[model samples]
Each structure stands twice: as structure tokens, then as C-alpha cells.
Target: MLTQLTISNFAIVKQLELDWRNGMTTITGETGAGKSIAIDALGLCLGDRAVTNVVRPNTKKADLSATFDIKKNKPANTWLSQHDLEGDDECILRRVISSEGRSKAYINGSPVPLTQLKELGRLLINIHGQHDHQLIVKASEQRRLLDNYAKHQNLIDDVSYYAKKWAELTNELERLQTSQAQREAEQQLLQYQVKELDEFSICEGEFETLENDYKKFSNSQSILEDTLTTLELACDNEQFNILDSLRQCVDRLIQYSDIDGDLANVSTIYQDALIQLEDASNDLRHFHERLELDPQQFQVIEERYSNAINLARKHQVSPESLHIKHQELLQALANISGDDSRQEQIFVELDKTKIDYLEAAKRLSDSRSKAAGEISQLITSSIQELNMPHGQFKAHVSTKEGEQLSSHGLDDITFLVSINPGQALEAMHKVASGGELSRISLAMQVILADKVTSPALIFDEVDVGISGPTASMVGDKLKQLAKTTQVICVTHLPQVACKGHQQYFVAKLTDGEHTETTVTELSEQARVKEIARLLAGDKISEHSLANASELLAS
Candidate 1:
């Protein structure tokens, strides 16, 4: 339900803030009092196309915003959750249109696209104006209304799931059918590549180890010469050898050990150094013996390294990535091997899914067909009470070989009506009088009241062509709907406005030379004055006030 609306610099409405209550709220004022502007502002907030002309002539921008209570609207909350928005019970939607043809939309102060605003609008309010009355006549729209009325959540879910699967299968079939030559060429190339790779029998890490060995073997001669020279100077050379010098120093230190306590420690260090040099010399001699040069081994190493490098370059990958490419080619080969079986499986599954989905859809259609009869009877009874004694209303459900199924079903549903006796029933849009359409709209709402999820239903002059007893009944019907859902209406009829739990009056006023529009919620006394004015003229006569008071009391 809409809790509040604030409009600024929009057409004739300079600034207006309306606090709306739950249940039926009626807005009434004189003609040209900017009532349409108020509705237009609501439409703009609901993502209607914006025009700079709708803004006040001298203003930079026009702003329209409203707050809605979604405590009872679970569908809207789920939609919000899907969009990654916090689903508070209260939601505020705001829109601003600039004179420069720029518009901004926001939900709960966070900026959003107009598309999102429109999506949220569908869940929040359903405004049935003249255009909407015409929409009721369309068969597709009728089907949607019936589905909504029936609250077929499971059927809707199943149809959507199957429709997506059907679409995917159709796309896959097209790809496979149309790309046959290209796929064959790709398969041929992949087969040749896989055969070449399989003959190699390559192992992971082998390339890196081979390269390391090649580097060591290539530098072995230079390495051996350097290490041997160092070892000779350190131990093998007779006079200048460090190990010989260390032995002489140890001999002198042992003699001085009796004179100094630390001399023995120095002698032990020299002895350890001599032992380490001897072990190093022995290891260097073994390394020199092992460093034999082999041209054949070097050639083998280089040839293997070149093959790895050439393959890496040919494939536009590092030698390390050869393994991954090998696996990918093998997987592609497997896919090609199972291509026929996969296609057959998809075809079989597609047929089975279509059958399953059609069964569910048929079940839904059968239920709707039964419900349609009941709906026709219910609406006819409701409309007859509204003074359309000769009115004939019917729900026509037709099934054809549809091109595709929709979220609703494969069948088409339309509302048929005949205004006069002996007249053949036609589509609902063909109805001429505004009064009849309002009655029909009311009848549909009455029948669908239980299944529609909108917390608030707003009627913008839906009672336009109705008057007298019919107007009073429309008001009563709106009041009845208010028990389950909030109902708001804009009307010129005092009877319609009188039935509201809350009443608002939009009036044009002049502040100095400027003209603006203002809306005020009427108190009981104020309502009497307003209703009396609506009954009579600008002057509220005593009799009119009495009549108004009587109407309110009743």
C-alpha cells in the first residue's frame, strides 16, 4: 500500500505531500484541478516515459516520490531479494525528471535504473485507467489476469523451467545443425594434433630436469678446472699449501700449550682445519675423475632440448604447458567420440521434458477452464447488481498450436462481453461506455480479489461514467475490496468519495500571481463541506451539508 506521495515542481503541482492510509482512499476535486497531474506523477514514479514538458515551466526539474508498505507483499520482497536489495517492509520509490530531459530513479534512496523501478511498480500498484480498461479485452492480458487470479505458482514455475530448457535445446540444435562443416573441420584438425601428441608419450617435469642436466654438463669442464686449482692451493701444493701451513702452526701451538691455557684450543682448531682440507682434496679428486666429456651424450641432450623448445614454440606455449594442451586435446577427442550419443540423449530428453511440461500445462489449463466458468458466473452476478441487467460477460479460453509456451500456458484466454440483448459477445476492449468498463473492471477485481498480490489497488477515475445507484455500488465494492487489500480511487462522484475510510481533495489555488495545486486529507467535517460542494456548487448549502452528513452516517 502506498503510504505517502510527495510531488514538487511537476506541471501545476508546485509542491504537494499526501499521506495515504490503508483501505479505500478517494480523491475528488473540480475539473482541471490537476487531478490528472497527480496520477501522471504516480505514473512517472512507476517508470512511465518521462518528458521535460511535464515539468513546471520555470523549474529545473520535477520530483515525485512515494513510500509503500510491503509487509503483506511477499512477491515484491522476493523480487527485491533477487535484485540484491534489502527487503524492508517499507519501500520508498522516487523519481526526478529534469527540464533537460534527464531523469533519475531511486529505491530507498539508492539509485536504480528506470527498468528496475518499473519492475517494482508492477508488484506495488495496478492502475486501471481508460487504457487499462482496453487492455482487459486482449486475450493475452486476460490469460495473465486469470493466472494471477488463480495464483498458480507451481504451474508458472514449471512452465518457466521447461520454456528455458526448450529454448536452450533449440539453440543447441541450431548450433549443431548449422555448424556441421565447421565442426567437422575442427574435429579433423584436433584428431591429427592428438595423434601427433600421443606418439611423443611426454612426461611432466622431464623437460625441466633435462634442461638442468644440459646446463650442468655444458659447464662441467670449466667447473672441474677451477675446483682442482683451488684444491691444490689449499692442500695438494707442497710448500704454499694452507693445510701444510696449518700443520706447522699446530706443532708450534702444542709446544706453547704448557705456557698458556688457550694454546691447546688453538692447536685443536688447526687440527680440525687440516682434517677438513684433506676430505675436500679427496672429494675434488673424485669429481675430476667423474668429469669425462662425451660428445654423443651432449648431442643427445641438445637434440632432446631442441625438440621440446620447438614443440613449445609451435604450440605457442611454454614446455611446461605441453601437458595441459595434451589433456585438452584428449578431452576434445572424447567429446567427439560421444557426440552422436550426446545428441541422441538431448533429443530424447527434450521430447520427454516437453511431454512433462505439457502435462502440467494441460492440468493448469483444465483448472483454469473450470475456474473460468465459475469466474464468468461470479462476474455476471456482480455486474448485474451494478445495473447492467442485460450485460453478458464470458471468459473465453481458447487453445491453439502455439508457437511457444509462455509463463502462463500455451492457451489463449480472452474476456468477451455483450452490452445489449440479442447482441453477439465481442472482446472486452470493444465496450464503448466508460461506465460499463468500470463495472466490468470491478467485477474482474471482485472475482480476482483473493489471488492478486498487490497490497494496494488504485483506480484513477475508474467510476467515471457511472452515477446514481451504480456509483454507490462501485463505492461499496471498493469498500469491500478494502477489507482484503487497500483500494484508492479518484472520482467526481460524492457517493464514491463518501465510501472511503480516508478522503483527499486536490484543489488548484493561487498564491499571489502563482498558481499551484494542493492536496489535503479531509476530516469528517471537512468531508461534509467538500462532499456538499461536490453535490452542489462552490457554495455549500445547508441542505447539501445535511445530505452529505446523511450519506457519511449511512
Candidate 2:
């Protein structure tokens, strides 16, 4: 429910602040007292288009704002959370229109796009006025209202689920059908590549290891010769090799061992040296023998390395990556083969899904039609009490074969009205007068209040052209409506004013030479005075005041 409104620099309203109550509130004043300006300001905050002409004279900008209490509005809370805005049961919406035709919108002091503000505004209030009743003539609005009353949650859910499934399955079918030839062609290429790679039977790290081994074998002769020379210098078999010469010297020294003890110890060291030289000579011979290399084997290894590198370059990959490429090609071939089978399945599923969607949609349509009949009867029943004794009301539901299904399902609905008996029940646009439309609109609203979740409803002169008992009925209905949702009405009917939980009088005053709009909340006595003024025009006679008090007391 709207808790407050502030307007500044708007046409004819310099600055006005209004604190609203939770129930029915009535605003009444003399002609041209800027009552409509307040509504316009609220519309601007709700993201209505604005013109520079709406700005006050000599003012650069005009601003309007409204605050709403949201504890009871779960939809609004969810919407705020979805938009990443603060949602603590209170929301403030503000719009500023500049003389230069620039406008800015804010929600809870955070900047927001105009569309977002409009979306949020819709959840808070439904503003119905004389002109807005033309919406009753629209088929879409009638359909929406019927569905809202039908409360077909299960049917709605089923339709939504099947519709989504149909969309997804159909998309898959199209993609597979359109790409079938391409996928087959790709399969051919993938199969060929996979076969070619399998024929090579390449091994991981084989190229690098083989290349290193080949390098070593190619230089085997030089390596072996160097090893032989080093071994021979340490110990060799030819030229007394060190071992035979050392052995003879040690034997000669041993013969004189008895003549010199120190010489005997030297002979033992020479013997040990002879044994080490013989071991080195055997190692030298083994090294020379192992140096043998095959020229043909070296050439084969080189050719194989070249082939691997060439293949790597041709495929734009390293030799080591060939194994990965092989696996990828095989996988691609598998995917291509599966595409045909999956495509057929998807097509079958699409047909089935769409059939299911249409079936659910049909149920929803049937249910809506049934509910629309009952709702029309209820509305018709309310109209007579609203002083339209002869008025005829009808909810027309039409279904054309080719009509598109929307989130709300597939049916065209239009409300028809006949102001008097024997008159044709034409479209609402054709027969509803300003006052009659307001009552009709009010009747529908009253009937549908329990179904609609909006927390606040604003009616702009809904009592226009109505007086007497009918006006009193409208007031009484608004008062009853206040029990559920907040209701505000801009009215000239003193009877309506008398039924309000609160009354505000809008007045125009001049301070020096500047005119400004002012609003004053009426006390009990003052309300009677205002209601009396509304009853007797400019003169407040004792009889009118007494009548006003009696009306208030009642």
C-alpha cells in the first residue's frame, strides 16, 4: 500500500506532501484545485511518459515520489530481490522530469531503468479511472481477468512445462535435421583420419628416445676408440703390458728379500700393482670389441626420425601429440555416427511434446471459459446494486484455430455491455458512458478483489456523473474494499467523502503572487464542513452541515 507521496515543481504544485492511510482515503476539493496533479505525479513515478510542459513555470525540473509498505506483497518482495534491490517491506519510487525533457527514476534511492520502475509500480497499485476503463474493451484484459479468477494453478503449470519441453525438443530437432548432411560429411573425414592414425601405430616418447639412441650409435666408433686409448694408457696387454714387467721385477726383488727386509715390503707392493694392471687390460679389450656399429641400422633410424617429424609438421602438431590427435579423431567419428540416431529421436519427441502442450492449453482454455461465464454472472449481479438496473454485461470468449498461445494460454476475451434492456450487448467501448464505465469497472474490481493480489487500488473520480444512492453505494463498496487492500479515490461526491477512513481537501492558494497547490487532512468537524461544502456548492448551510454530520455518523 502507498504510504506517502511527495510532489515538487510539478505543474500547479510547487511542493506538496501527503501521508496516506491504509484504508479508503478520499480527496475532494473545488474545481481546478489540482486534484488530478497528484494523480499525474503518481503516474510519473510509475514510469509514465512526461513532457516538458508538465514542469512548473521557470522551474528546471519537476519531481514526484511515492512510498509503499510491502509486508503483505510477496510478489513485490520477490521482484525487488530479483533486481538486486533492497526489499525490507518498504519501497520508495521517485521520478524527476526536467524542463529539457530528461527524466530519471529511482527505487529506494537507487537508480533504476524506467521499465524496471514500471514493473515494480504495477505490483503495488492498480489505478482505474474513466479513460482506463477502455481496457475493458480489450480482449486480452478480459482473458487475463478470467484466468486470474479461474485460479488454474495446476493447468497453468502443466501448460508451461509442456510448452518449454516442446520448445527445447523442437530446437534440437531443427538443428539435427538441418545439420544432418554436414554431420555425415564430417563423419567421413573423421573416419579416414582415425584409420590413418591407427595404421601408423605410433608410440608415446618413441621419437625422442630413438633420436637420442641414434645419435649415440652414429658416433660409436669415435667413442669406442677414445675408451680404448684411455684403457690402454692405464693398463695394456702388449709391450710387457705393466703386469708382466712388474711381475718379473717383483720376483727379482723377492730373491734378495733376506739381504734387506725393506726391499721385501716393496716387492709385495709391486705384486699388487701387477694384478690391477691385468684387470685394466681385460677391460680395454672389452671396450674395443663393443665399439662395432652397423651403418644400415643408423640409416634406418635417421629415416624413421625424419618421417615422424614430417608427419608432425603436416598435422601442425609435435610428434608427441600424434597420440592425442588419434583419440580425438576417433571420438569425432563416434559423435558423427550417433548424430543420425539422436536426430530421429528428437523429432519424435518434439511431436509428442507439442501434442501434450496443446492438450494442456486446451484444458486451460476450457477452464477459463467456464470461469468467465460465472464471473460475468457475478458482475451482472453487482451492476443492478450500483444503480444500473437494466444494464447487461457479458464476457465473450472466442477461440480461433490459428491464434498463438501465450503464457496465459490461447483464447481471445472481450467484455460486452448493454446500458439498457433490449440494447445489443456491444463491446464495452461502444456503450459504456464515463459514469457507467466507472461503475462497471468498479463492479468488476469489487468482484475480483479477492483474486487480485495488488496491495493498493486508486480510483480517479470513479464516481464522476454519479450521485444519490448510487454514489453512496460506490462509497460503501470502497469502504468495504478497504478491509483487504488500501483504497484511494479522487471524488467530488460528498457521499463518498463521508464514507472515507480519512479525507483530504486539495486547495489552490497564492502566496504573494505565486500560486501553489496545498492539501489539508480534515479533522472530524472539518470533514463535516468540507462534506457540507461539497453538498451545497459554495454555501455551507446549517441543513447541509447537519446532513453531512448525519452521513458521517451513519
Model 1 whole-model lDDT (C-alpha atoms)? 0.82
Query: Estimated TM-score per prediction?
Result: 0.82, 0.68
- Summing lDDT over every window of 10 consecutive residues in candidate 1, give the lowest-scoring window: 130-139
lDDT of 2 by residue, 74-96 (tens): 88899998898875779999999
Segments of candidate 2 deviating more than 4 angstroms: 8-13, 30-33, 40-65, 69-124, 178-336, 396-407, 423-427, 430-434, 463-469, 508-515, 524-554
Please report how far candidate 2 places residue 251 from its true position, in Å. Answer: 37
lDDT of each candidate versus the true structure: 0.82, 0.83
Candidate 1 vs. true structure, TM-score: 0.82
The TM-score leader among the candidates is 1
Q: Candidate 1 lDDT, tens digit per residue, 172-239? A: 77777787788788889989988877876568888888799789888988888898898888887876
